[model samples]
Target chain A: MKTLVYVAHDNVHLGDATLATVTAASKLGEVHLLVAGAGCGAVAEAASRIAGIGKVHVADDAACEHQLAENIAPLIAGLMTDHDAVLFPATTTGKNIAPRVAALLDVMQISDILSVEGERTFTRPIYAGNAIATVESSDAKLVITVRGTAFDKAEAEGGAAEIAAVASTDDAGKSSFVSAELAKSERPELTSAKIIVSGGRALKDSATFENIVMPLADKLGAGVGASRAAVDAGYVPNDYQVGQTGKIVAPEVYIAIGISGAIQHLAGMKDSKTIIAINKDEDAPIFQVADIGLVADLYQAVPELTAAL
Target chain B: MKALVPVKRVIDYNVKPRVKADGSGVDLANVKMSMNPFDEIAVEEAVRLKEAGQIDEIVVVSIGPAKAQETLRAALAMGADSALLIETEEAIEPLAVAKMLKAVSGEVEPGLIILGKQAIDDDSNQTGQMLAGLMNLPQGTFASKVELEGDHVRVTREVDGGLETVRLSTPAIITTDLRLNEPRYASLPNIMKAKKKPLEIKTPADYGVDIAPRLKTLNVSEPPVRQAGVKVADVDELIARLKAMGVA
Candidate 1:
């Protein structure tokens, strides 16, 4: 079966970079891609290296940037003929675009997928990632947004495939971008990061937030995060916020500082492999799930830890 | 000015979802269901904006089945002015839901539209943005703080990277993040009033919408189980154990 995975590039010719482990999913049939028109050549060359991938389709177009629903949704719907199924990295962009595309194709969408068990059955999160639910797509064509971290990266092999130019669909009337404000980040993207360090409102002040958390994160080569409480308290920016309503993170080492773990808050980071809590309140809820609980004031402990590192 | 707060009926977030023996879906036969926790936050914010005298009236609207009326009533009990239920027997796709909201928005003439960032059941999180797109209005998505000033609503929105403050003109849409507020419970008097308050039920047919579902479900299954690890007695031991797993 021919499968297409969308990659983040100017267009879709780029290869699938899977750094994580693969289970039965790694064995899916010939993998192909539909990337942006701008870098279609480069993307196609890269896709050739993915061990299981056979063909590459470049839907290269300037309009493809940002992967807006109007243009990409119809484009994906048209491409359904060439493949048995389609896959997307379960990022925010994928979440918005995938289902809309599925709708346009009149097909079912299995999203935020953690695993693929069969030709039609998929496992996904339920109740905000607290539990997993297995879903089956009865439709002939399956479209899914797979959680990128959960899958093993397709190994690269040097064999290029010809890039097929799928006809473009004009979405001039769909929607126009008034403006977008993408938060500037100096660290690795949150979902893809290996380590994450988060804080909460107990830090008391916004100015003190960066001072108390950033340095420690810098030392550990970790992404910085804040509990929804801290963001709502206006102590940090939303991009730094991690929780049920924010982002679900599963880093190798997750350090929670001054956070009182609400179920919503825990929903985001509880999936992390190693959990460490640093809070003055020994009774803080975060300590309950923490692999390491430090009973010390964040104001004092943060600076000390930064200096020690 | 009229303000519209969209409510979502989802599995009570506090309760864990269990799969049925048949693998059909979550075993919700008797599981607790409530207004999506985030919708409660949206309702609370709109109510506060109304109570603080910044907004005139609040309407809670749900785009679901007859059962969704329960969610709308819950919003009314929390101090909304009225309730609207877009009764669609079939599951309403986000795009279609956005389209219906735009049509209703034209009639209600709301200065602000407040809804949860994502519904817990599907977690699509697209309706708000799609609605804004169809209406050609600005949006404050994942807002943590919002204020009404002059002709603009200065909102602090949660972006993937950080917070952004946008000054959207009066008729803009805002989706509430979970931490937007710790929702207030319905008071006794308001609950009593909500029972008597008028609830306008308009089917999608009434709105002249077809309400066709765009996406279909193939199958729903459970995620892989992570083994619960043993608890450690001390920090040193914990670190040592984590290091052994190469997870520290």
Candidate 2:
């Protein structure tokens, strides 16, 4: 099977999610990466080095700098003439663009697939990960978005693939970028972080949450996350949320502090390799999935743990 | 200007879905159904826009079973002027739903279309984007904040790294995210008033859209349960356990 994998990038650096997506696409057959952005030759060069890639198609155009769906979807659809399946990393950008391509291709899209069971069958989480459904598509062409955490990351370097330039498409003139207010953090990104230290509403306010959670995360060199309750309570930005409605993470270790894990919260991080929960309440549901449970007041234990570490 | 909001009735977010023993799909028998939480935010945003006088009329739509009128009425209680229900007993995918909404849009010709990012049941975040694609309209998806300025709408979108703002002309699409707004409950008086609101029911055939299943579900099952591990006595033991596990 021939596949087209849209490279997840920000017009400068390649996103780690694309590595996992490349791994997922490799499961089907040869993987051809598509890098579409203004002056994104470096991203294309980086993608060509991924071990299993067959080729990298670069669409360097000003119209795609922001990766707007209006321009990118049509570009992808036009390239689908030679490919049987197209895979996108299920990021906000991918989710916004893939469905449009599917509509342009006159096919249905399978969103956030957890596994590629066969050429046309895959498993995905539904009802906030409560149920898993294995679905098969009868469409002649397939459009899919791969959940990054579900698959192992492909090797970043090792192989050399040909980089080809494709003609750029015209601007759709429907939407225009105004500004961006991305959160600037010194720590790693949540999805790609090896270790994550997440707090909940028990942290009280934003100041206290930052004071308590940041030091531990800094000490461990880990990414910071928060439960939806904490995010809703205005303790942190919405980007820090780690739950079913938020970001799904599967890190080497996940530390839950004062978090009474709701089902939605657990759905995001239950796949972590090791989970440690420190909540004063012994009956908190987070303990049900935690690998190591510590029943203690986070106010005291967290400080002590941070200092000790 | 008129605003169009599409909502879905699904199992209440508070309830856990149960997969049938036969592995066909989720068991919805005797399940408590409510407007999808994200769609509630959409309806709330539309009502707030109308109250602010930016919108003259708000028309809500739902493509589901006959019972979906209840969902539409709930939107009406939240201050929609009227509602349209594309009634169907068959399971309609997002692509078909987008097609039917496209047909409805041809008649409504609303200035703005608002939708929930994804329904919690199917968790397929596709319909709104697909609708925008089919109609060749600009889209501001996963919007946290929306503001109207003359003929253009500015939206603050929730993206992977952080927030992005974009400007789209009138007759655009906006999908609500979790942080958009807190939805208000329908009061008794408004619920009574909603009963008198105009509701029109149509079928997929009226739209000339085929609601066929492009994807077939082979089986549905629960995810593997994570086994609970032992509790540590203190922070030192927890640290030691982590060290032993090679993850500290």
The Cα error of candidate 2 at residue A276, in Å, is 0.6
Residue-wise lDDT of candidate 2 within A107-174, one digit each (tens)? 99999999999999999999999999999999999999999999999999997999999987899998
Which 10-residue window in model 1 chain A sums to the lowest lDDT?
A15-24
Question: Which digits, one per residue and each the tens of the lDDT, describe model 1 over residues B69-164?
Answer: 888889999999889898876767676787788889988899999988788877766677667656656666677788888677877765554555
Task: Indicate the worst ten consecutive residues by lDDT in candidate 1 chain B.
Answer: B225-234
Residue-wise C-alpha lDDT for candidate 2, range B1-248, written one tens digit per residue: 99999999999998989999999999999999999999999999999999999999999999999999999999999999999999999999999999999999999999999999999999999999999999999999999999999899999999988899999988999999988898999999999999999999999999999898999999999999999999999999987887787765
Candidate lDDT scores, in order, read 0.71, 0.94
- TM-scores, each model vs. reference: 0.75, 0.99
Model 1 stretches astray by more than 4 angstroms: A10-28, A37-49, A156-159, A280-283, A299-302, B1-6, B14-33, B40-67, B76-115, B122-159, B162-197, B200-248
Top candidate when judged by DockQ against the true structure = 2
Query: What DockQ do you compute for every candidate structure?
Result: 0.24, 0.88
Off by over 4 Å in 2: none
